[model samples]
Structure formats: structure tokens, C-alpha cells
Target: MTTATPYDAMFSGVIGQDYEMLKLLAPLAVEMSRLVGATVSQHPKTDDKPLSVVELGGGTGITTLSILAATDAIQLLSVDNEPVMQGQAQKKLQAWQAQGKLAFCLDDALSALQQLANGSVDVVASAYTLHNFTNGYRQQVISEIFRVLKPAGQFVNGDRYALDDIDQHTRTTQTEVGRYFRILTAANKLDLLEHWMVHLFSDESENHIMRESLALQQLAAAGFAGIHLSNRSEVNALVTAYKPR
Candidate 1:
């Protein structure tokens, strides 16, 4: 039997089945745009120019829409590797693309970020996406984000985190699973709920969420300054780090 990839097991068909679950990222995206705007305003060179924002793993474009609504004069690029997710976003964001406000790229996040020139972007954002990477690869991706950002640019991500304490991590994981159970149950989609329970609660290598402190440390090691946890719950968090001027 063929082994299931992370994308195949957890992410494939996610947009069609649980798009509402993805909308939870919208508030985080708004905060990311706010930080991006504030950071850009502090730099006179980029203040007047259109903000260049790159979103990694732009699933379904809900977060994209939130960012666009939160900021003005932005040139947004929504990049993802999944065709189905990109297709869903493209349909919703077509009007914005026609108006030169948005563009969708079907590409891997790391390669796309690497191809951009140094200091070419004002902000790099992602939601519930980076956790898909292992701890080591996630650090490399963070470093790449640091590389492409303009001076004083921000990297904002809202995603799940693991705790340092094993017991706490277990507890948090259980709570998160329970929360999802309630959500899926209330939606009256028990069939989908069963799939998600296995996908989320399973100890899969692809679901290796890093400890919040370690993630912050990785950002600092990548030369990001002003690292901050903007929001947090037991398992979910929004973190922001800045490229120093």
C-alpha cells in the first residue's frame, strides 16, 4: 500500500469540507496587516509605495480577504502548492486580481520566497500553515521570510503550538481535539468529524507542532527582532517578528 503524504492525509479536500474552520485565521490576518501597515509607516521609503504582502499557504483566500480589507494600497500575493485550494481562492479573488490588488501563485512557499529579491517584500504572513512543517524545516522557512522582507518588515503567523512539558502538551492536544469535536458536532457533520479526529489527533510526523518558546527562539536566531506572541490559546497562537532596520 502507498503511504499517505501529509497533504494527502490532512490537507487534501480540507477547503471543501471545513472552510469555516479556516475562517478562524481571518482575525489573525487582520492583525498581521495592521502590523505590516504600522511597520511600513515607520519607514519613509516604503510608506507611500504600495505594500507588497506575500502570504504563504493561502488556503481558500479567507485570510487574503481579511488582509485586503484591513489595509489599503497593498499588492498581495497568495502562494500555495495545492491546486484545489488555489482554485477556490482564485474564484473568490478574481475581482481583486483584475483590479491589480491581488495575485495567486501555485508554488511552494519556500521556493517562491527564495526567488524574491532581498528586501522586496513588506510583510510575510501565514495562518495555520507553518505547523505543517517539521521543526527544522520550519526554521529554514522562517529564515527565508527574514531574507525577503524589507527593513522593519514583519512576519506574522497564526498556527498551532506544542508545549514544552509533555503532560501539558498532551492536555492541550486533548482540549484542541475536543474543541474540534464540538465544532464538527454542532455543524451536524459527524462523518467529517471522524476524519478530522484521526487527522488532527494522530501522532503523525507531519503534525509536529513546535513549542511556542522554541519557535520564538528560532525567529530570533534568524535575526528577527521584536519577536512577540500577539495572541495565544492552549494550542493556537499568533506570533509576529520584525526584521530590524
Candidate 2:
């Protein structure tokens, strides 16, 4: 598991299908960047220069790679709990890190956030990972994101959130999420996500489920403002909320 091929643990052989999901997700992804940029650009500390960005839960580094490739980040750090995942990302972003343009860390998202100086980051990002935690833990993890972000920093994602009533005990719920959940009641994409989860757990009973409405409340509870649903497709939803300075 500690070997270089981290996506093996992060995807369970399923993330290879992610690029396909982008067809339904791209426009929303663009809006996400706009929201983040609008906020970061207004930072009192912001000059004409692009700000630093850190992608939490940056599994296999695809999302991090996109951000690194597309933006002018002063620094980019890829954080994940799995060393394999982080290692995979480190390899992808190594050339940038080699030039001191980016860095990667093998740590839980919250711990990685803790390693940064408070209010020092322009953006704290995660993709498809928040719903992986129970309600309480997710809140704690996100609050840590708040602590690390500069006054006008942003939290952005093309993440997958879940619906309630799945009867998964290890999960917590806030609101119902995703455009597809309301359609494929029985054969939800969780079935696909499970392909990615099989190596980590013994049963589906321990999986985390999300409800969108409740999640927004949780984000609000954490003192985030501008909660918005950016876009949607069959299974994934583009969403964002921000920490007010």
C-alpha cells in the first residue's frame, strides 16, 4: 500500500472512469474556479499575482493536476490520508515541486491543514472526499479548512455528495445530493463508488452517505457563506461554500 501506485487504493480500479463523468461536469467545474477566483482576487493581501492553492483529498492527483495545470498558484499542495494516493500525486506534480512550484503531503486532510500557518492560504480545496467522513468528523475537517484559509479564501469541489435513507449506519447526513440520486433509486452510482471502496472496508454498512440540504446547513453551521450548487449531471454535483474572512 505504501508503494508508489496510490490510485490503486484511492480508486479500487474505478477512478479510471472519472474522465467520463467530466462530460456532464465541465461547465460547472469552470464556475467553481470563477467563484474561487472572485473571492481570492479580492483578498487584501492579494496582488495581481495568482494565489496559492491546496487540494485536500486530492486522490491520485488528477484534481490537483488540473488546478496546477490551469491556474497560476504560488504553491499547490496535494493532501490525502493514503500514502499511496499522495505518492501518486507527488509523482505527477514532481516536476512542479522540483521547480519548487508545488508540494505533496501524506497526511489526513485536517492534519495537513494544521501544518499550514493559520489564515495563510488563499484556497483550500477537496474533491469527492468530504462525504467519505461521518457528519461530525466532516465538520471538524472542514472547520480546519476554515482555519487555514486566508480571510477571503475559497473551498471548491466537483465532489460527490450522497442522499439519505440509504440505511448506511457509518454515514452521516445533512441534505440530499446529486442529480442522479433522484433518478436511479436502486442502481445508484454508489454501486460504482463501491468498486473504489472494496479494498478499504468489509461491507457497505460502513460507507458514508450524503444529503445535500443538510450538508449546506452544516457548511452554514461552520460559518461559511455563499453556499452554492455550481452544476450537476447524472451522478455528480459541482458544489462550493466559502469561509468568510
RMSD of each candidate relative to the true structure: 3.7, 7.3
Write one digit per residue (lDDT tens) for candidate 2, span 1-245. 33575434344345443424433423454444344444433434466555677777776666666666656546777777775556667766778888776777778877777788888877776666776676667778878887887776777766554434455422322112233343223545664444334422321224444566777787788788988875554224656767775
lDDT (0-100) at residue 242 of candidate 1? 84
Error of 1 at 4 (Å): 7.6
Model 2 steric clash total: 9
**CA deviation > 4 Å runs, candidate 1:** 1-7, 14-16, 21-45, 185-188, 202-207
Best lDDT among the predictions, by candidate number: 1
| Candidate 1 lDDT, 1-245, residue by residue in tens | 13463343455565344655633423344454344345433433456778888999887776777677666688989998887777888988888899998988887888888889998898887777787776776877888999999998888777766666769878867766677677767878775666666556433344366677888898999999988885565666678788999
TM-score of 1: 0.82
lDDT per model vs. reference = 0.72, 0.60
Stretches off by above 4 angstroms in model 2 are 1-45, 48-50, 163-194, 197-207
Q: In candidate 1, list every pair of residues with a backbone clash.
A: none
